[model samples]
Target: MTTPPSPPNPKAIIFDLLTGLLDSWTLWDASTPTGTSLEGRKWRKQYLEVTFGSTVYGPGSTYEELVARSAGESGLPNSAPEALLQNWKDLTAWPEVGRVLRALREKGYLLGVVTNCSKKLGHAAVRNAEKAAEGAGEGTWKFDAAVTAEETGWYKPAVQAYHGILPLLGEGVRPEDVLFVAGSAGDVVGATKAGFRVVWNNHVGLERKGDVLPLREGKSLDEALRDFL
Candidate 1:
């Protein structure tokens, strides 16, 4: 009889910041003038398309600028992007985020973040994530390291962007040994192509577009990471 594949044993767990760990979608939606869910999703979808389509990070335009561009494309007023930026600190974690992260930390798995944003926003967002955990009485949730597209000069799925996190995770952590928790369908393909095993926290029920699949997928963080935890 043929042997079944062994389960993944990851040394480190890397996450996609925006949607994976945080309820950034609500904040993004509220940023619009109308503050309607539909408008917010429209803007966010445009933003994702623009950034992911770029492949390489564009130094010419700041991350904030892209937000404004997405607003315009989504038929939102120019004021929409500014509101989003100003309200960034209000981003909260998903219901299962705080608990799951602490569990992983207790298990001694190295934790990190890899996101597509500027260095300033990237770090600040994670700090906000910590505050959300604190509010939930989950204690201080900290990551060992974080990598941003601005730092790598490449957007995710570019391989380089995902690969950039390895050195920061310390020696002996390799792509195959790391488990990437993806927030979006694109990241599933991106992390896998970068050689990391992936688990998708597909909160919004987004469709998977690429050939490569995550080892597991669920609508909640805890559900997706059930086996790993």
Candidate 2:
């Protein structure tokens, strides 16, 4: 006897907007290193590790301000932090990202963008994406809803953030029925524990850790999402 076909998609897919969908690492990499010494590089890396989440979700803190703080703490050149902020404000989505997002929308997925950023920057990222697509003639892109941690008062890797905001996005949607896309290990772990199936968007071949694997992992956004597509 033949088996019945499965449904075409989940109830929705939530994106970890910045690093996950926007490829922040690529841009981060192009910046001049803060220092040449091994200790200095290590220190800068540590600063990034903290700044990525804390600055966004911290009460009254924005990415730009916290990044400058990180630069100072990391002992970087004076000009570095503002340059980083400008790069951030000018962020654009990756080539083909808009097309994929459009495809997902057409496929009937209720899309969401969750980011640890100020409300202004979170929305700015979406608008930036729209501009990027238009400038590249890639086509328009939009999401059904967006959540910023600054508004919610929580950050990723914390279960409260996911469990709290999801209901607001799609009432009655179960975590098991939600798909989350993320690039960082903290994000992967948080999403898994929150009960959403995760796409570990490991676009740079970062070594996977522990045994609790993502529902999928890949070197490109398209590859990480192939299963759903």
Candidate 3:
């Protein structure tokens, strides 16, 4: 048996589609009224300060620490910290994500979504993606595969989470043949570690932390795909 030649075009463009928790998650909106514009980043900054006591500062912090900090401040018992995690369904897609994803799919590339969301929310995000695609003038944006944290038992920055997608691919896909797009530095590090070409979706123009090294950076998914092409 011989391995197939790597696809001249990528076999898949794997996306770490963060759940609408920042934009749509009702719990977050209720907790803070800053609106989704920069509200998510603001909450996360406060969350880090409140939870980490000045130690860890960003989303790049270890998931265990994040959960621990959030649970502590959330007034939830550490024994069952699940409830402290933010609800994701309240998030709405960014204005252009739907249209861009649909267009990418129409261009004949395989599309996959990987997220650190619970299964229920993950499914909702996919539906949101499909709807967004439709609004963008594409009828539907169906993914070839979708992996949620509930299925992977890990989160971004964990090599296991990235590796979890490998076996889900169809016959010819290789890790190197997939391009991952993520908005967070930790996610970029994890994806790069897992051997995927990574594109940082730096929509806000945040500076990269020292540890993360992405293959490319773009201000939007459209720009990211353009560079990929």
Candidate 4:
């Protein structure tokens, strides 16, 4: 078993939107029929990996379409999937997330968020983290940059998406200098392919398959780094 890597004194930390920062699974867990606790959210993640790229529809679709389809596929039809999309704005950082971010900021690491949402929704999600962080007395969640597929017209795990985000991370930040925080297997592989070091935010005990290695992994961002200290 390859252990997670220690941070190479990262210049910035770029977080994945859906699973990295917010708790999107709870929403799925609330529904998911047949057998009562089959974990429909896992299906949703796999669905995203498929739909975010070339599938039946070709290339990809918007966040709205993705959510609606995932909901419908997971037995949440007539569940107002679009309403769930808006619910992102109401999400707070997962437990200890704000504290971990504050610690990184104290060390002068710039922070960012990368998502496959529109310009409008992506920024709103950032505000969601900002609210949660500050309310936790961890200071405001300030990001040095934010990127969305809607803004760049490319979903993640694709070189184009990472390229779109790299330049926005700030003046001197290099692809090698930024630490990409991955919430899923696709994220880990994608960011690695993009030549960025990575940290796996494995909050849900998701398996780490394939050859892509991460800098670290932990239930919470804080606990992950403890190995290095």
Candidate 5:
């Protein structure tokens, strides 16, 4: 069956939904052995082990499930603890990213942040984005809505994550009206499947294969927006 065309001007907003879309490599890079890349995942596993004290595996055994189990186990006061927030807040924007987003926002588009990061990390990233936007002389970029995986109870590649945010948008918005920006192929696929206008921010020059071609592609946030707008 043929797919319908996307709406030209959506009542809804644009979403930069994840660490990749908000923060640059510094926040997500796991090259440092103790960083989230290597240690973050392990930390989550161990945290869950200590908290749950049992091998609690959910469907797909995905990172999102593990994080949920850990949060349930930690019983930590905040949705995201200080340690995680400190680690995540250190992220910065890629070259011209702030400028591009500001340009889009000035065009009267509502900007939102939907991320798979735990609530703490997601909020931290948003704070960083606000700082970057300020530095760019754009004033603080306030998100129309910021939805984290913790709140949604699902992760990217799962339809629920996208569906969960639909109600938060303005009335009369449909999936196609949203521009879902993602750097990872999996995110691109997931957003596309959810009926969004997928914008792949391929910063690292990763190989693209089947299905990757159908969506919009950009090497940086600036490049993506240039084509998108």
Candidate 6:
């Protein structure tokens, strides 16, 4: 298929944190009892179901609690989530992410992250990305906005979650003016419904879940976003 052109003069670029910028699957896999990607994927799939299917996220809600619940639903032993949390700092960025983000920054695009986790885990993931970028010699890049589901009190695909990023991106930035880099299938529909053009980094090659399509789709961050950079 022919690639779609980048949006004309987007005011900002928002990203989904875990799958968009980071190789979070490996971490999830390593935390599983079998330490196999197959097992990890099974658990991760269940986790996605629980997370995306939820309707609300309040002060009492948390990413950790959801992880544990997913593990149980996956029939994974209790040790899986315990290990996952214990090694949260091990979250790593996709190899090309640092370079891709650096290029976008160089082009004067405003960058941000809107992730489906609590504020604490969301910020920690950003720190991990920074460290990974530094190691890649991309220096340090700052996000104009880093929003989380907990902060929004709603999950992705929810209009509120997508809308929440707008105010944080400062006054006058509208959803249609933003380019959202989606990490998962659900995000394409979510971001589109909220009025942002999307570019999906479909690293795992999951099936498309909705009628909406991203402006671009690729197997890596760089490939998915190179046109814009």
Per lDDT, the best of the predicted structures is 6
Which residue runs of candidate 5 sit more than 4 Å off their true CA positions?
A: 1-7, 11-13, 17-19, 28-31, 34-86, 209-214
Residue-wise C-alpha lDDT for candidate 5, range 102-201, written one tens digit per residue: 7777787767776655676567777777666777784456667777666776666577777677777767667877877766666666677788776677
lDDT of 2 by residue, 25-49 (tens): 5445444363233433443455546
For every model shown, what is its TM-score relative to the native structure?
Answer: 0.93, 0.79, 0.72, 0.84, 0.70, 0.93
lDDT of 6 by residue, 123-196 (tens): 99988876765666644657778889898999887989888989887888998789999998888888888888
What Cα-based lDDT does every candidate model obtain?
0.84, 0.67, 0.60, 0.69, 0.58, 0.85
2 versus 5: better TM-score goes to: 2
Q: Could you give the candidate ranking by TM-score, starting with the highest? A: 6, 1, 4, 2, 3, 5
Stretches of candidate 3 off by over 4 Å are: 1-8, 19-30, 33-42, 45-88
lDDT of 1 at 227: 84
lDDT of 4 at 24: 66
Looking at candidate 1, what is the lDDT of residue 171? Answer: 96
Compose the digit string of candidate 3's lDDT tens values, residues 89-195.
Answer: 44566677876776677777788887765567677777767677777783445778888766776665566777677778787788878888876665666677777
TM-score of 6: 0.93
Q: List model 4 lDDT by residue over 94-157, tens digit each.
A: 8776666676677787888888676777788777776667776743467778888777777887
In candidate 4, position 165 carries an lDDT of: 74
Model 5 root mean square deviation, Cα atoms:
7.0
Candidate 2, pairs of clashing residues: none
